[model samples]
Target: MAKTQLNVRVDEDTARAARERALERGMSVNRYIEELVRQDTGEAGHTFVEAAADFMKQYESVFAEEFGAAHEGRGEGSREHRNEGRR
Candidate 1:
């Protein structure tokens, strides 16, 4: 893949922090920024729907458990009783 240069301006403190973080991570500042952008843009490149689906799949069990707990003991037909021919 071809790489392009991007010049951005930041406050002195932010630049210093970025440099320190990059050094701590053993990456050049450019690579650090690239990684930040990659994460912000999402891995596997820009497919938000795929990412959302993966997120849902990952948390589906948790969601189901919470939902079941919330609805537990409501009894069957509780919802229908509430509606009661209101259509």
Candidate 2:
């Protein structure tokens, strides 16, 4: 694929950390940044929510057996109560 150069200005500390991360991952800073962009744009596949949902689906039977029918009676009020102090 044809690629274009992108210039981004970040703080020196951020740049240093990014370089260290790239080295740890055995990739160049350019490739590391490309991966970050890809993940941010959802081009890397299986976002966090999607993956979590998939995992839940896969373990639905086990979770249901462990938790039993208790979850069904829980209403939206429980969520509202839980978030009461946050915002």
Assess candidate 2 and give its TM-score to the true structure.
0.52
All models: lDDT? 0.87, 0.88
Best by lDDT: 2
All-Cα superposition RMSD per candidate: 5.6, 8.6
lDDT of 1 by residue, 1-87 (tens): 899988999999999999999999999999999889888878635666788889989999999898877777576657966787687
lDDT of 2 by residue, 29-78 (tens): 99999999889998777676788899999999999977766565556556
- List the candidate 2 regions with Cα displacement exceeding 4 Å: 46-87
By summed lDDT, the worst window of 10 consecutive residues in model 2 runs over 68-77
Whole-structure CA lDDT of model 2: 0.88
* Clashing pairs in model 1, backbone N/Cα/C closer than 3 A: none
